[model samples]
Target chain A: MKKNEVPQDKSNLESVNFKELCYAVDENGEYTTAHSTGWDPKTIALNKAIEEIHERTENAKQRVLNNTTSPIEYYMELHKMDLPILSSYVGFWKWRVKRHFKPKVFNKLPQKTLQKYADVFDISIDKLKNIADGN
Target chain B: MEIKFTHHQSAHCENGVVSNLMKHNGFNISEPMVFGIGSGLLFCYIPFLKVNHAPAITYRSMPGSIFKRFAKRVGIKIKHEKFSNPKDAKVRLDQNLANNNPVGLQVGVYNLEYFPDEYRFHFNAHNLIVYGKENNTYLISDPVMESVTSLSEKQLEKVRFAKGAFAPKGHIYYPTNFPKELNIESAIIKGIKQTCRDMLAPVPIVGVKGIRMVAKLIRKWPKKKGTKVANHYLGQIVRMQEEIGTGGGGFRYIFAAFLQESSKILKNPKLAELSTEMTQIGDLWRDFALDLSRIYKNRSAKEDAYNNVAIQLETIADKEEVFFKALKKAI
Candidate 1:
């Protein structure tokens, strides 16, 4: 032990109550070095944390990578997954447009165009709307 | 729809239990969370599909469930290894020994394929029991189960199974406790504690900024609820003191820690500057611990706080007991 390193007694070690320590964090990161036990909880906690980090770094690499996903990463991963999007005339129209394909001027005259598209896929109007407008 | 960050709040239900948390979420948690040791569920190894958070709700188990699940554990692919690793090896060995000896369930299931007439398996689940082609032959049958003496198919048939056998063949039956589902409800409870604590854990510098957050909570809290709410909120705050294990042992811990640290500060003339902030923080926590202790003392008076807790715990324990008893009797 260093000259400045005060040897820990039972009181100092006991004072660092786990409940208060937990609450000190809960009630706004309020903490004190002293507890009944005279143990430095922050140091103890920090050391424990560092130990756990090292343990995880050594032991659970795959799990860490899997759990390390952020919201953006989650979205990106979801996008990468082969999401099934129904394809049809109207769907084709939207997909084509969304893909930056120029909409043909005479894409389809009104009459049975929408109905014909729905007929081809055997879907309802709502599903067609969902497919077409990205609902 | 995108699972927004806000929805995370709703993800846990009114009671704070989660019916199901994307399975991945389930994997993130350990079993200690839903552990109602006495009366929660019969089979410990029966993989929970919908761990309900509510105390009222029980495992959707009917009769005969224990036999099926226990049998699965007793089946095949049972591998035994001598204890070697330092971490979980002792615990595993102890559990195994207890299970193999008696009173502990250590078997697992293996290749339980469904056929028209008979089920096929490659190995016995329990190595403790020998499979000599007769009743005693229980060495191994399935990959999931291991370490067993007696507690066989014959025993299972004799034991009491739940009347509800509409469940899958692999479904566990229990005569004792119906499990409380630990889904959104538990997540909410845990989240409330963890998130609330996490929010509280920013260095609350004793001056203006620290005061501001407390004031903000006061104002925002009022806007959300009236005096009743305030009282309840205060009660919650008080409850948290206990939840975080504050009043019981926290004060002693803090005092001792501070005493040690403070002594070092006194001794270290050179590093004396380093002790100032640490000392201040330590002092505040000491004070807080005292305040929380006072609250706990008061709260206990209002009701038989521990009695209530014990009562609540008993219900859970009873179910577990019944389930295990029924399971033992059945197997």
Candidate 2:
């Protein structure tokens, strides 16, 4: 936390707007003012968060391809949601959400249910069902 | 219509918004000053109020309260509204922008496009400014961003109505009147005393004592929930400290900086000494975060790691207790 303290180099610090405190001395040397300097450690923390999201998304993606999970599983992971969170978002019971992870049940989900999931994930029903190639 | 507003990035959103809005209206104020005057600093670890499936661990007061308090203390009148209808909300916002009036809004972070992909979360207390609109996009001055940006009306609506946990509910605010001068001296003392009261409040789950409560829980987490669950919970604490709406070190550094500014304004050397003490507390908080990150990086952290983190938390709580008590008596 010095005005010029450098953050330890971390791979995830790329493209981060880490906020930090910076002090500026006045011309009279009577006082120093503190201002935000935007430092590296902030980015490192954010990067760690993003890495967690991507790691979960990747694992969920693998499950979908292996036919062990449904596309809802992939979308949930992609959006960094846990089962309880996704359930709350879609207003579904957690048990039902766990059931929706099965391809058989997920494929039979009502259009309205699909829409709810789509809205929560900020995607369209088609994309939610398809688990978009780009995702 | 365009409002000529200057945006300065700051460590926390609400403080930045207050600072920018005040400056836009001809008042030169810093974020820390706004924060301190508003009595925005507080610590609470509520176990029942879940955010993202973890207990609510907040580093500041609830959203919108700070601005309201700061405005009142400085003798400024402000207008605030929360629309139940998204359509009506958008119309009202557009009307304000068309009048060349800059407005402050609370929106969820998950859908803010300018946010880094990894940083997106369901936090609903993020503050930003909307100064104008062009075509389908609304010009934005999110204090956390390096430069002003724009968001599509569609995108804006989505985030405005973001549903889960601490929903924004289409809240918007703007200053209706401004005072020419402020009682800086009185405000500073009031800020100091209020901060002390909050930190030393008798509530077992809040203030300095709350920090200790969380420390105790941290020590127990591993024993009750196994290592993986405990590590994830610890990571959540670090996230709240370093990443979430909190400024660095859970607002410790920002509050410390506020004290430093208060010292100069009030010409009190004792407050300056206390400011340095607060900075040391911020350092301790940062060290705690570093330790948490190291545990996350190395999943095989032993029981000693959790105990060490708990001890750090206890030490921070103890220091803050003393600091706030002294701050209360100093003013």
TM-score of each: 0.20, 0.88
Chain B TM-score against the true chain B, candidate 1? 0.23
**Model 1 spans > 4 angstroms off:** A1-135, B1-214, B242-244, B247-331
Write candidate 2's Cα lDDT for B189-233 as tens digits.
877778788889999899998999998998888899887667667
- In model 2, the number of clashes is 0
Cα lDDT tens digits, model 1, A10-41, are 32123322111121211222222211222333
How well does candidate 1 match the true structure in TM-score terms?
0.20
Once model 1 is optimally superposed onto the true structure by TM-score, how far is the C-alpha of residue A74 displaced, in angstroms?
39
Instruction: Evaluate every candidate with DockQ and list the scores.
Output: 0.03, 0.27
lDDT of 2 at A39: 34
Q: Which ranges of candidate 2 are over 4 A from the true structure?
A: A6-13, A16-70, A82-108, A124-127, A130-135, B244-247
TM-score of predicted model 2? 0.88
Model 2, position B28, has a per-residue lDDT of 88
Clash number for each model: 132, 0
**lDDT of model 1, residue B288:** 39
Model 2 residue B63 CA deviation in Å: 2.1
